[model samples]
Target: MSEQKKAEKIVGVKGMNDILPADAPLWELFENTVHSVLKSYGFQQIRTPIVEPTALFARGLGAVTDIVEKEMYSFTDSMNGDQLTLRPENTAGVVRAALEHNLTYDGPKRLWYVGPMFRHERPQRGRYRQFHQVGAEAVGFTGPDVDAELIMMCQRLWDDLGLSDIRLELNSIGNAEERNKHRVDLIAYFEQHKELLDTDAQRRLHANPLRILDTKNPTMQEMVNAAPKLLDYLGEESRAHFEGVQKILNHNNIPFTINPRLVRGMDYYNRTVFEWVTDQLGSQGTVCGGGRYDPLIEMFGGKPTPACGFAMGVERILELMKASGEQYAPNQCDVYVVHQGEAAQLQSFVLAERLRTAGLDVVLHCASANGGGSFKAQMKRADGSGAAFAVIIGEDEVTANTAVVKHLRAEEGAEQNQVSVEFDAVVDYVVDQIVGHGHDHDHDHDHVHYHP
Candidate 1:
């Protein structure tokens, strides 16, 4: 085959990845943790379409934002000439759904989403073009307590993940008019120091000078210190709201740093913005980050509703957990029924189903050429699967209406204590053996025998 054809057949597209089954347990752990936390907090799941009308995001996320300007995977639809884009974030689409479905008609809604986001960018460690996010949003509440609750939920998620060394950075972007005044002030400040600004900063200085404060250019960084502060320009209401937020956070004993320069990239955000940064993963810092986009609902043509939300990057969190030696134990399969022949395969299936109905996970041996790989290989696969015990069924055991249940992690060259149990008693016997005792399967073996 030609190189191009070979490449097309073998490799995933750039900036995309196939999450292999080996990593699935980690994803499940994080996903389940998020669901548990959200459920305890009374957040309902709201799924939005992956592709949406281009105008929805263009208007809601702001046209000049980086997500709209550079990162969006936008294309014209072949069926309907309507321009469409794969969602880069959930908020805009969620807000659009709330408007179209008239969800805001009744009252405030606490909503969340967990799914993929598409962004065309240089893929790196813990970052992918198509990545998963677990996010929550509270619509129609402007109180600081709502903000504090969101922050607390984020902390809860981090705690559940067992992530350490995380820092909370909070900021207020102020109300619209105050923010407008600060924008003009920033433009004037950067214009005076234009000579020191880098090309990007110089360009942003005129267009959106507050973005200059976010620039990483050393010269711009120095200018940022002297740049205008949003706090000084905060209107009376904005100031009081900010103070209320601080008070609530203090009441909850949540530590945070006020970053005056922390302007969210989206135009809809106002009043509060925060980020959860960690030092665990090298270079890639933010594991979770989001802010209150109070004006987004109205901006999307819904009745005015205040909303706050945050999205946790699952891949980033997993990477950090792995780096910190936080192990997510693999999913436990209750029984691994090894079949010696086609007849045994049928018998194993029946036994596996019985275990399944009893609320247990079971994996059956499907190897056609059974003797090619040794019992050791079978045991390794069973152990790696985190199965409770190995059910070794051969012609002898099947004919006798019983099977040998071997301890999967018995010491090498040591005799495995096999329990001969009637076929009907197998499920109960295995459950008693696995869950009743602290059995160690020694899953940390260096060699991996991949089995499904």
Candidate 2:
């Protein structure tokens, strides 16, 4: 008989990654920093589903936009024949939820969210098919102060994260009326330079003329630079709103540049738009970007509400952190309980729980089928666990109601010593030595630690 063929090994889907034990600490640190900063500004957390009606995004983001036209993971529901999409961006879903629940009917709300978003795009260094974002939204407020405050909040986050390279790029797209006038002029100019327009630019010319200004094509740079500026078409009210936002940022010492070509890709944005960009990440430089989208809530069938928000790519920010030499050390327990013999094993388990109850993290070594291994092997495992102290239990110690405590992590020039402690005194001894003595055995830090 012929030999049977082997099946192929399974792996994670492309561009979707798993956060392994080694890399989880950095993600936790980033999340903690974001939560603390958001809490400081009275922003509450809001969670929305990862899937929503396909029309939500098609309406929120323009149908011609890349996300809706190309990148979204959309499918037809088998049970009901409904069209559903894995959210490529979160702003639309958030607005849909707010409208569904009438969250802003009474007043304004400051909401934030952190979760994974899916987009079927070509994966690169910082961009992925499945990536995470930390977003903040201010709903039912129509003033420039909220816009400026959101920008300032982002600045505060960067400062807290020890990031110094990111800079702010600001712009104003005006309301629909002003944008219409500019759009007409912009389309006329693109028609004049039709020969120089690239395929992407030409395609976006009639659909989303404003996005043409953000083209990176070297050949079309000169033409795009000379296109009609949105800043010039701002009416009195729009200009004042733009100026109001700038004044607050200026007074707060937040330096920014007014970039006429910084129109964001979303169709919902209007009046004010800003991006926190950096030179570190190649090609994909905008780490965080958002702006005012006052018409979105009303468009979603809710009473007219003013809103603005922003979202930062978590993977990109974490990459920047790693590049800047930021370290997030893994959390380690304070004590590892090593045991031998049946009686000693039972006693080790009991004592480990006691130590844990006393606000200490303990790792109890379980007995193996191979005669529970040797004492040297168990001690090696204890040391490898990064514990500052190891509690040894044997038949003799179990009988005497005592444990042999060995100091595994010792300071420079300090002697590594072992001491005998009664079972009743073990918890206090471990706590005092680890916490009171400042041995730094506990991997406790002000920031969050990731658990796998």
Candidate 3:
């Protein structure tokens, strides 16, 4: 016999994590909360392609920014020789879509997105190469009212998610003209302390001197702190715009601190930059970051338009949610249908479909190596499925056209509390019990429970 070649296992790419079943409950909780919170703020969802032109980011995010220079996953397509990149951040892609489709032609539009973004970075807690972001962009809005509204919306989400200790820090980088003047002093100041500037800082000295102020190099901290604060250079109009956002936030009782060193990774952000930071998550403490990018639409070949948005890291927030000590059950389905015998198997399928038709999640058990597993074995699988109810059918029940409903989540050591119902009445009986149980827990505090 010829030698057989062995097959080797191929694993997922590093830093691209799989959302295993065990962790899915927490992810579902976070996503559902986000959808509800965004909808409350009148923001509608917008989805864009994962791949966009390489030049879009090069021109939009500034070629010198770390995201464009080091982090972006860009390549030239072999098929058509078109330069493409998996988006590192979604703001640019969102703006490109809006411009291409004239989405804002009618008037201003509020859009939101939730999807994965690609970035090549050392993976660690709360960060990955393939990470998900839930962002909201208010396009064509020209005032600080929207700015404050977006921040308030974030606070509402944190509150709803039972998160605490995440604080907001704000600053204004000023308009292009104002930033130019600050850039001048920032370069000169860093030039004096050239020895203190790291290799990255030295390279960015003239090209992007402002970003050095955001450096985490401990050696350069003292010098960078003394570098010109952008807030000191804000023009009267920029100052007024920043104050307007603050006035609204203060009135709404959203507390924040002014961090002069707070700067965004992108060059597009002009004024009113802010970050929601936390003591947790180690060095990657920024849970969310965003700012007003008034000039971006014009830069994208659209008319002069004002826009502001924010994106929160889904993994990071989930980590915080875990720390909050909330528990979640991995509910695969609401009802698990277990059957034995040929006739019971067919009847189980029919009953499952009917339950689903009534808007209930149902799981129908199938025979394994042990054909028509004893009722004992099938019931074990049902208990492990995280199902609240189990519909048991055997040859006897098939003959009688009845199903035994077993309460799966009943109190510890409590009776199974099995109920026998006709096949025609199974759907109504299951739904009434589920719905009535919810009402008792939510409203009827004095409701009595039936025990064996």
Off by over 4 Å in 1: 1-8, 368-380, 410-416, 438-452
Separate clash counts for every candidate: 0, 0, 0
Provide the overall lDDT of each model, using Cα atoms, as 2-decimal numbers: 0.80, 0.90, 0.88
1-452, model 3: which lDDT tens digit per residue?
Answer: 98889899899999999999899889988999999999998899999999999999998999898888889899999999999999999999999999999999899999999999999989888889999999999999988899999999999999999998899999999998998998888888888999898999989998888778889899889888888888989989999999999999999999999999988657789888889999988998999998899888898888888999999999999989988888876747788999888998999888898877676778899767866477887888898887789999998998998999988888777764788999888888877777877621212323323221
Relative to the true structure, candidate 1 reaches a TM of 0.90
How many times do residue backbones clash in model 1?
0
The digit string of per-residue lDDT tens for model 1 on 405-439 reads: 87765567865467788988887776666555655
Model 1 is weakest, by summed lDDT over 10 consecutive residues, at 443-452
Error of 1 at 203 (Å): 2.2
Residue range with the least summed lDDT across 10 consecutive positions in model 3: 439-448
What's the TM for model 2?
A: 0.94
Which numbered prediction scores highest in lDDT against the true structure? 2
> How well does each candidate superpose onto the true structure, as a TM-score?
0.90, 0.94, 0.94
Q: How much lDDT does candidate 3 score?
A: 0.88
